[model samples]
Target chain A: MNGDLSALPGIVALTLGVGAVATAAMLAPAVALGFCLARGNFRGKALVQALVAVPMVLPPVAVGFALLILLGRNGPLAFVWSALDIDLVFSWWAAVIAAAVVGFPLLTRACEQAFGEVDVRFEQVARSLGLGPLRSFFAVTLPLARRGVLYGSLLAFTRALGEFGATALVAGIIPGRTETLALGIYSRVQLGDESGALALCAASFAIALIAMLVAEGWLRRSRP
Target chain B: MSQRTSRIRCHIDRPGFSLDVDVGWDERVAVVFGPSGSGKSTLFEIVLGLERCAGAHIRIGGSTFDDEAAGLYLPTECRDLGWVPQSPTLFPHLSVSENLDFGRARAADRDPAARKRAIEVLEIGDLLGRSIDQLSGGEAQRVAIARALASGPSALLLDEPLAALDLPLRARVLPYLMRVRDQLDLPILYITHDPDEAQLIGDIIVVLDAGRIVASGAPRDVLWSRAVLPLSEALGLENVFEGGIRREHGSPTFVSNAGLQLVLPVSLDGDTRVRIGLRAEDVVLAADRPGKISARNVLESRVIACDDRDGDVYVSLDAGEKLVAKVTAAAAAQLALAPGSTVYAIVKAQALRRLG
Candidate 1:
């Protein structure tokens, strides 16, 4: 590796690309789960809530180990990949999955809080306005809670950028490919490259800080 | 005009409360009056289909929204009912124009004329460009109402739509409300706990108490009904007796309901539908009929029930119809009055103020 601007595009792509895909996965699943928890009335709601929060408390390595058993080539779900003729192990996609797993709780928790803070009166008013339940949610509930959704997205993105332990187990830092900024920092430190590790660490922190600031500012600007 | 023959029947069951009622409306405004936590908003929820209920049958203008027995149900979106809530809730992210357009776009009648008509009807054309956040509470409320009205709904359901405003702001919005009521043919279900608001706008009053409709009829009849004697005494309003005045004995005047005579100070005509005010404290009870007392009005009344609330004790008496009087516990003990006890009720004629 040389100190040249030629590799900047790949590095930028890695930074933005990993953040975007992993963040999207985290945001999508967590939001879906959040919506379910927020709106559903069932006997097992408390148990379901406990299940959603389990990933947040578990050790990152344990989470990676569990995923490895379910998703690895020799694991229980190996046939699923074989049937689809796809590769998941030791790939950039695996890194995205690991990052998403690490990031999902942040997104889901934020989304759940956002949805909870919403007043039920809005939905009632919408229904009384002649919109049905489904229409009311789309027309009023979703729009009113948009700020929270955005905040959750930003939180997920930051969490995804910082993922290390789970990605390390699932994807195993591969230079110029599966190597995320967090993984890159770890590798640099392991190889006794102090300057490189510090540089990457500072970059990652700056990215996360900027993301939080933007999200906070946007939410404040859009508050009802 | 079709609304005159139709009334809405709604049944709702919630935690700690349930409401079952069949209500119809004419061209006139029907105000649902009740105390706080009397399931007013919950009733609106069932009617609006925001909250689910079992065996609920609702109809507006003969259009069936829910028929549990028939297994027919129409969702809220198809119901086409406008709603105005107390809070001035407008979509914050959308400009007022977009918010107005949001409802119009979803409405089955999406004509430009309909959209324009809604803005004109609600009188919010000037606030179109402004964002929801920039609006004052009143402006936001107007926009919300306009957006709902844009849908071309069959009727309007208002859930304490003016409660969020202070008295002065409420006065400001009254004209617009009056205009809407006068100009539009739409039937409106106005819910309020305020007696003043009810008296101002209500043609028919449906009084709800503790999840049940206690009384419903013309506002005048319900307000001063002998059936609601207990409620009036509880409210500490001026209570009056309806009867004809009989011959005077000495300085005391007598008014008789049916054949039951009550003494008062005023001497008036013998046969007329007259109302007299007899304050709860002014009414003294005696176990036996009294003579030579300054109290002009006296009656033989049987105690119906007793309710001790706060500092005042309420004794409900049935003097043909019913009468409730608020007395101190000391006064109640002094009279030795309990349920099923017969007593003489005396009201001075001066207390018999005539009502129009």
Candidate 2:
């Protein structure tokens, strides 16, 4: 019990730090995809939408295998990996890439719905007031959709914190290198370490519960 | 150089209908009056550069904003024109002051005097701190207009800005619109379907029907024209006259166009030219000149046309001008009225209402 307690601070820090980086890396692409899905009209739009939805519907293991094929030592980018003299696999960066891939869809769908609900006439009015399109979007549309964006980022962060299957496959369970809270919990359970598993589970539940509460409060405050 | 005139010539082809119009204006308030689906809004959208138009040529203040032949097309932001749509578009996420400042910040001129004048004219100083959702419909509209004005556009386009308000609210907002037109020195293109609104503020009136300009002139001239009489008749204002108030035999009278004089109960104090409207039901028709009638005014007229409407006969008469009289078919048969038949149209002085 004392040993598990001693390891708690390090586990929490690793989970939070990795989750934040994964969410930040996914932010711009998620917002752009959300806006396009909500407002754009183009050929193959349905195909693009279906492609974005794959990560949400597919099993987490399948996503992990796909990433391994792309970033593994003998994978597609072997030459670049050799040139950089650093392997991405079994590293903290591998965990972030895995978490970002898995968490992207939730962020995108939430933001898409938010942007869809905004009236286009408001943007048009802004343009008529001498604002260019991009300026109007930032001035009018983005502020109106801020609540959804925040909610989506929180959801993505939470998803990243609990990421296990993809991170295990790509980043491996190296305790001090890449083992997140979720992976730590799994490794402890597999090794029959009951006390460590329980502690990690309690910590995960606390973080997720706090995230949900904050999200609910944020949505209420920002609703128009 | 002569005072610049705004000219618009455009052709917009839609699925079920197309709009083609050529018009020019230099008036302080140029009103676009039309029925629903008459392409009035489409015309405004084209001028604002929000909707694409083929072969569009728009020039304001001697600068060409859009000319297909000249291959010139400016975007909405570059056109420098303010727009107030029918609904109040105060940004939901902003306070009144912040919304107003949004436009002020983007204005090329950015004159503090103009911003101050707009805020004062709209009377929205007290609402600066209020959120958009807290405002009444009339207050929101005032804010929208003020925001547009703060942009310092050379012209303003108002698309039925008061149509969403109830009657009392519309009345309250109208004075501010008039002030903006009269005091701002900015040309305004006002679109509306309400005849009263068109008559009240229009320096030049353009009537559109079926996506075409039916008539364009001064309000009185267009409203009283033969092309517009049927529209007014359908709107229940059967007798519309523009005339000068005069004193005859120590009594007040109204002398209308075509040299027809009408006895009035009271004289207008200031205005010489007055617009008077009477309902069709108010005019009593007689085949022969009646001897003892309480009605104070009578006109010798010729019956021009008659139509049956819901068991009543709507008789059209030329009493030195066009007039409509609603009488029963039985009464028309008893009087033996027909085309070119001479008749006397009797109306009471109290029945005449000052329309504008």
Candidate 3:
């Protein structure tokens, strides 16, 4: 049992590192898409919205397969893939990419709701005060919607921490290399190592609980 | 100060309603008088470039912000104008001083002296540290006005800034607006549905109804015009008149511009121009002259229009001065009232209220 669980610390570090990186990388695109979905009026808006929600509703394995076909080594991106001469499959970056795709819809939906709650009048007032539209959005709208954005990021972080099917297919559970907590637990359970699987589950619960607590505290502090 | 003019010619189409207006004004304070849903706010939005209306031509101080025929359009940020909506929309995440600084920092021709004067005029010096949520309605409006002034705008547009406050708070904030109009050199466009507010602050008045300008002139002239009288009457400024004060029979009498006279209970020491108001329900119309009456003023009038409300009749009378009398339909029928019929308007001394 001890020998099997020796990789627990490595798994924890990998999960935390990949989760944080994925959350950070997803923030900008999520915010932009959220604002557009909430405030913009243009053609193909519904199509864009549906595309964003695809990963959340579709099977995680299916999402991973779709990503594999697009970014895999001899795929349609073969020119750039050969130019870079780098393997994206079975790498830590693959885990980050899978986690980001799975968590994006949740983050964007939360952020869209948040931006929708902010009154457009505040932005108008900012523009009237001589700030341009983009500046007004950054200065007035974003700060006012800070709590929502923070909560969405935390949700995305938690979701990234538990990503299983996509990470398993894309990164392929290499011990001490790309294995996260979920993949480690799955590997232990498949190998009939009940104690190791239970320990990994406990760690996952703790991380999720901490993320929720921080989100709640942030929401409380931001309440006007 | 050199005279400046604002010219606006716009046509906006909305669902179920459209606004088409062309007007110009050089007054220091121009009041856009209209009822709710009169496209007053839409007019402001078009001028501020918040709403797009094609073929619109807007020029202020010789600068063309929007001339659609020439295909030139300026965004709201590029326009040299400040706006205060009906609600005091202070940024909730900021303090009062930060809100004021927001305007000052972005102004192209930022004026520190003007900002300091605005702070002094609005008397918001002590509220600089308070958060936005801590302010009362009146205080928030004062801060909003001062913040707009800090931007050093060439013109200011206020969309019923006092409409959110109660009567006492509105009264408290109105004087600050008056001070801004009197002290500042910029033109101001104040939109309001209340006729009293229009009369009190308007140097020039433009009356709008159903998205069209029905009348435009001096406050007394436009507000008292036949087209605007019914709208003003609905807003509770019925029987409004501009009159000169005079002493007669040891009492003060008000002689109106239409050559009608009324004995007022209150005394004005010297001869001065004053506005007088009487409630529509307070004026009693009598078909026959009564022998013994305690009412102070009685004038011969002709019934011009009678409109049937729920159970009462709104009788518009021309007593040399326009007066509206709300009486029961039974009484109107009993008196056989119709257009061009003679009647006497009996107003008690206490019913006449002096407005500024």
Candidate 4:
């Protein structure tokens, strides 16, 4: 338990670092996708939307396998990146990218639903009032959809924190580097260090509980 | 060819229908009278630039918003037009004050002074800090109106803004429109199908029917023409007949359209095709024609059709064409007027509307 608990600081950093990256990756695209789905009329939108949701539905390990081939040293991605002299194979940053790929669609889907739920009537009123589309989106649409977007961001963060299979497959479980709480605990369990694994599991439970509480609070606030 | 505010004439072509409307504003409240789906909103949308349709050339205050001949289209945000939709679409996120500011591109001066002036004009100073959800329907509508007027637009287009509200609520907000007319001093294109509203707000009334302009002129003149007379009839206007001028001595009496000659209750001019309306309740039907009756106007006609609506009977009489009259079953039974019965349809002078 002492050794397990000593690893908490590094695990917490890994979780925070990965979560921040995931949120950064998801937020911009989520907003753009939300607006596009809310207002755009185009062919192949359905296909693009299904492709977005696939990462969410696919097993994290399965997504990792696909990414490994695409992003590995001898893979197509690395061949392209070879001229840039950047290594994506076994690094903490690679783990964050892996987490983001798995978590992005959840945030985006929630944002799309939120944006869709806002009545276009408000936008019409703003336009009539001389507020243009850019001003209208910021002044009306964004504020109305805030609660849903906020909750979606929170979910993305929590997902990135709990990510294990994909992160481990893409960015090997290097101690104090790529090892998040989930991956750290898994490594300890494989070594038969039951006490260490138990400590990490308790810490993960506490973080997950806090995340759920925040999400529930936001959900309640979004309603009447 | 002549331009004051510049005559607005545009032809907007959609899939199967086109909105071809021509309006010239000199110094009158022009009413766009039409039913829903008769391209009412589309007309306003083209003006506002929210919709794009070919061959729409719109100019307000000598600024062209759209000119299809020149391949130009201004976006809605830059149209500089005031608009009020049927639904009171107040921004849920903004307070009453912010909503007004969103359209205050007109007063480019001190922002606070502009807002203060808006609050004063709209009389909504107290509602400035209040959120949209807290406002009532009437309050929300007033704010929406206030917000539109704050911009000091070149043109104001109101699309049946009072239609969604109940009768009492509509009555409440009408005075504000009067204030807008007086205070804003902008050319208003008020759209509605309600005749009463048209008569009230319209200086020049344009009647739209089935995607075409059936009639357009001064309010009274349009409503009083033979071409537009049938519309007034359909609106339950009592049929007034020319009852002839002064029975034997000096008095003004008129003949009705159905050739019913009667004495004068009020002063009326020469024998003409004076169309009128009879309220079903106004006409007191009798079994046999009474000669010495106090009522001024009376006509003999046969019943055409009778149907029971609620507790009253809606009886149509074939005078010249179909003249609909309302009567109770008791009145119908007393007269024994069922389809083939010939009876006298008595009308008051006041119920007889003149079509010039």
DockQ of each: 0.35, 0.64, 0.52, 0.41
Q: How close is every model to the real structure, measured as TM-score?
A: 0.74, 0.82, 0.84, 0.76
Q: Which stretches of candidate 3 lie over 4 Å from their true place?
A: A1-5, B1-4, B238-356
Name the top lDDT candidate.
3
Model 4 spans > 4 angstroms off: A1-3, A222-224, B1-28, B109-114, B223-356
Task: List CA RMSD, all candidates.
Answer: 10.3, 5.7, 5.8, 9.7
Residue B268 shift from truth in candidate 4, angstroms:
30
- Candidate topping DockQ: 2
Ranking of all predicted structures according to lDDT, beginning with the best and ending with the worst: 3, 2, 4, 1
What is the CAPRI rating of model 3's predicted complex? medium
What lDDT tens digits, residue by residue, belong to model 3 across residues B26-112? 767889999999999999999999998887988765567998878899999988787898898999999999998887765647565
**TM value for model 3:** 0.84
Candidate 4 local lDDT, B1-356, one digit each (tens): 33645355677666877777776556447788766677877777777777776666677656678877778887887777778887877777678888877877654531335446556766888898998898878788888877777766667778886778776677567656656666655678888866556655676887776667778887655654556655754653343332235445564555444444544445444443332334556767766778886776676889976666555776777665445677897777777778887877776766554332
- Residue pairs of candidate 3 with colliding backbone atoms: none
Please report, as a residue range, the 10-residue window in candidate 2 chain B with the lowest summed lDDT: B267-276
Q: After superposition, how far is residue B233 of candidate 4 from its true place, in Å?
A: 6.5
Model 1: per-residue Cα lDDT over B221-300, one tens digit each:
57546565456445545555445654554543444454556655444433344445556677777778997987655778
Model 4 / residue B148 / CA error / Å: 0.9
| Native contact share for candidate 3 | 0.71
Off by over 4 Å in 1: A1-12, A132-135, B1-4, B10-15, B24-28, B106-114, B229-356
